[model samples]
Target: MLAACRGFVFDLDGCVWQGEVLSPGAGEVLTALHRAGRRIAFLTNNSRATGPAIRAKLHRLGLAFAEHALTPLEIIGSVVAERFGRSRVLVIGAPELTAAVRAGGHDIVDVAAFRTATVVVVGNDFELTYERLAAAARAAAAGAPLVTPNVDPRLPIEGGDFLPGSGAIVAAVATAAGVRPVVVGKPESPLFRMALRRLGLEPAEAAMVGDSLESDVAGGRAVGMRTVLYAPGAPPAPGAADLVVRSFVELARAAGVG
Candidate 1:
């Protein structure tokens, strides 16, 4: 089922790396696919870091194909610009996300201007506070559009650790504001479409590989792409993905690559 695809899309946090440590056999599988002339795109829902930062980290990790990487950070600007015209934006995310929104010809306003904010963009804010959350909630409650990356509750990290993801933050605002945010990342069509565009392949010609069955698998399936679940531990459910692999080695074998 996996051998027919000419291109592949991978998720970052779990499938490629668990944190600063790269997942075992990930580089080998990617190299084999590249050598076999398969187009690949790295689509991550991680909104904390920009694309360049991720590329630099990939370089440091000695992973090739850094050029094919995309994160919510890189595409957020365009997503915002196209969704909402230039207006006052309240950003409850990292500095990089703020910069992206500003670069989109939107004004980044603080909590003081929440009442007048045209839209509220939410991501993972490390320095989150009740004040910030309340302001963002108020802004959204006041009819400002709310946008976020993905709602993955947990982010996989090294040593089998996890962190609260952007979804956690988005959830807080959503509950308080009583509004479902406009999601631009996984489980949504925008990011998947962007990844396909980058690879220049139709959904039928490529596969989406990631750990999250809800986000990656569902998102890919929504776009009519085959799905591969990189589940290293627990047993996969019946028909969760088109294919399920315990490691990149297994994925390579299944895909009939090197």
Candidate 2:
């Protein structure tokens, strides 16, 4: 099934690399695919990152294709601007996320003025504080719409360690605010459709390769694309993906690449 696909959508951070360390044989596989003229797209949920920064990292990492890359930041601003129009946003994320909201033409209100916020936006806040959390929650609780990039529970880092992801932080605010946020990233349709459109392929003609079963596999499956679960050093769940591989090398073999 994987060998027949025309396009391959890869998830960064985990599938292609774990933080600074590239996944074993990832570069070779991607290079081979690119040489074979396979359509490729890199989709990431890293809200703190920008498109140029991500592309720079990939170039340094030895993946040379100039494929279009998507980060939550690239789409976050547009999501807000299109849906809510110009409004005050109580942003609870990093500086990059704040810039996205600003670029979308939304005003970032101080948390102290949470009552005046027209929307509560959340994402990865590495320097999260109780105060920021409280203010965002208060804004959402008071009936401002809560919006978020993605709800990934944990993020993989260097040395095989993990950090609390955006979802982990969003959970706290959701519990306190008593509202479910409007999620814009994976496990959601917009990002998946955006990637598919970039590839110019119907869902069946493409495959989504990622480490997260929930975000990558389920999202791909929902859109009728084949899903490849990259379960390195662990047994993959049964029936979760159309194809399962232990590593990029294995995936390359299955896809008849490299």
Candidate 3:
């Protein structure tokens, strides 16, 4: 049931690898797809890494892909900058998130420098505290637009349990400030649209593959694209995907990629 598509989009981290442990045969699948001359892009909501960084990680894992073949924090940054401008933006995120914002020509402001903020961008911050949360809430309550990178609740780490993602932080800030943030990540966001545009493919001809039902499957399905759920240890939802597999290799097989 996986032999008719022109392009493929993959969600990183879970579907491809988890915390440096490459999913079994993941690289072989990607290698096969490349050999078959199929268009591939690694789509991710990991706002913690830039495209180059993600590319570096993939290279280290023995996967080969062009720099333009990945999208993550860069897209989110563009969205924020386009909507909120480059100056006076308060960010509650990690280095990559902040860097993405800055790369888009925006100024990053700390919570203490809140009075001048026109927007508040939130992502995964390991150093989060009540003070920062309160400051973000105040900024939002003061009429700053709230933008989130993605809503993944947890991220897999090498030897540790899943770490809380930006979603957890977004939930807390929204609850405290009584406002819902505009999320630019997956499952119901324009970020996928951005990817579609970048690939020059209509939504109907593109397919989204990921390991999660929330962002990858749900988000892709919501946008009318064929969706694949790669649940290595989890099962696909009853009716959430067009295809289900244990690895992206199955995705290539289905898409006639190799």
Candidate 4:
């Protein structure tokens, strides 16, 4: 199935590895794909890291590819620039995400400026606080529309642990503001469109590979691409994915690679 596709998009955390540990055969599968001349785009909804940082992490994990990784930070930045045009944003996320937004030509205002900001952008913030949340909520309530990179509720950590992701923060603000956020990451069309555009392939010419049923599978299906789910120990739900593999070795084999 994968052999026919000219481009391949992969989700980072669960699809490639859980936390710091690389998934079994992940490096091999990627190397095989590269050797086969397939265009690769590594997509992550994780807002905690930037593209170069993610590339560094992937290098540490023994998977080296072209530095063409995509994150919601870049996607959100483009969206904000296009929609609002240099609007001031109250950002709630990692410093890296804040920098990305600023680099995209948007002004990053402090929480004190929340009410005056045109948008409230939320991402993964390890240092989330009630004060920040309150300010964001107030801003949203005061007509600042909420924008989130992704609404992933939990992020996988090492040793089978999980951490609250940006979605948690978004939910808090949304509940307080009584308005749902405009999501820009996976399961949303913007992220997928960005990936497809980078790959220069139409949806039917590429395959979306990941471990999440909701994000990867549903997003790929929605965009008219083939979907491969790489979850172990779980039964495949009806029409959840076009292909299901337990490990990267299986994924490679299914792709007609050794």
Candidate 5:
């Protein structure tokens, strides 16, 4: 399936590794693909890190790609800037995401000043607190549009455990504010559109490989790209992927790599 494609998009966390450690065969398969002259883009919804930081992590794990990695922060931040130009924003996310927003020329305001915010962005905040939630909810309720990077409820970490992702925080704010957030990550068309633009390929000409059924598989399929679900030791959840593989070695072989 991969051999026919000119471009590839990979999800970073579970597909490449689980927290800094490269997955078995990940480096080899990726290196093989790179040698094959296929355009590759790493798409990640984790707003906790910036694109350069993610690229550095990939380098540390011995994987390199020519294209700059795309993250939700860049996509969403661009949208926010274009739509609201230098407006005050209430950000409840990681420091990396906050920095990204600030770099986009938006003013990051304190929760107490939520009334002045033009948009409210929610991401993974390990230090979430009730006070922050209340402030975000109040702002959203008062007409500030709620924006979330992704709606992933949980994120996989090392040791095979999962932790609450940005979705959890978004859900809380949504519930309190009585408004749904605009999700800008995978399973949404904006991020996929941006990726397709970067790859210079139509959706049908590319393949998306990732471990998550919802964000990766479903999102890829939604964008009309072929999807490959990498679910090790798990049976294919009917119609999940065009091809399901257990390991990157199998994926490499499927892609016509030795």
Candidate 6:
């Protein structure tokens, strides 16, 4: 399959590494694929870190990829910049999400503390509040696009309980405002388009490797690319992946990387 494909894209959270713990054989498979001269990209919906921070983590893990290989924040930044340039944004998400908004040259204002905002961007904020939710609802009612980073209802923590992800907030605000926000994450957004542009390959020639069936495999299928489900502890959903493996080493072998 590696010989048949020009590039590979992976989902980071569950596919590559779960939190600080690396998935089994992730590094080895990535190394082998790199040596095989296949282009690799990490296409993640995680809004918790900037691309630089993620790249740093991958580097520490000895994973090889170029600077332009990451497509999460940069893709989001471009989307926000294109739609809401210089507009005041009510940000209710992680610090990384806020940074992405700011890096796109938009203004971040406190939700309850905001007055003159044209848009409200929602991601996962551990410190989410009813007051902030109310404020976001007000902005959405006033015709601002309720932009969500990813619509994952629950995000898995490392060996712990799941937290309500951006999808939760989107649902709450949409319920209060009577409109669904525009979700910009895997399987829906321009992330794959950005990936294709970065990889310089057609969608049919690319493969997506991820653990989550909802985000990674679904995203790949949405764009007509081949999908590989890499489960460390999680398994593939029925009919979700073209292939399923427990470790990246198996994924590599299946891809003909060895």
* Per-model TM against the reference: 0.96, 0.96, 0.89, 0.94, 0.94, 0.88
What would the per-residue lDDT of candidate 3 be over residues 84-109, giving only the tens digit for each residue? 66667888988778887788788888
What would the per-residue lDDT of candidate 4 be over residues 1-258, giving only the tens digit for each residue? Answer: 777888889998877878989777888889898888888888999887777788888878877675678788776788888877888999988898888888888888898778789889988788889999999899889988888889998898777688987888889889999999988889987778888998899999999999888898899889999999988667677667889888888888877776
Higher-TM-score candidate among 1 and 5? 1
Question: Whose TM-score is higher: candidate 3's or candidate 5's?
Answer: 5
Give candidate 1's root-mean-square deviation (CA, Å): 1.3
Q: Check candidate 2 and list the clashing pairs.
A: none
Clashes of 6: 0
In candidate 2, what are the lDDT values of residues 1-258, reduced to their tens digit?
A: 888899999999788989987888888888899888899999998878887888889988887675678888878878887888888999999999999989998999997888999999999998888999999999999998899988999899987899999999999999999999888899887888988998999999999999998899999999999999999877766887888899888899889884
User: Ranking by TM-score, best first?
Assistant: 2, 1, 4, 5, 3, 6
For model 4, the stretches where C-alpha displacement exceeds 4 angstroms are: none
lDDT of each: 0.88, 0.89, 0.78, 0.85, 0.86, 0.77
Q: 1 or 6, which is superior by lDDT?
A: 1
What are the runs in model 5 whose C-alpha is more than 4 Å off? Answer: 83-86
Error of model 4, residue 1, in angstroms: 2.8
Model 6, residue 250: distance off in Å is 2.2
Query: Of the candidates numbered 1 and 5, which has the greater lDDT value?
Result: 1
Candidate 5 or 2, higher TM-score:
2
Superposed by TM-score, candidate 4 places the C-alpha of residue 84 at a distance from the truth, in angstroms, of 2.3
Off by over 4 Å in 3: 85-87, 256-258
RMSD of each: 1.3, 1.2, 2.3, 1.5, 1.6, 2.4
Ranking by lDDT: 2, 1, 5, 4, 3, 6
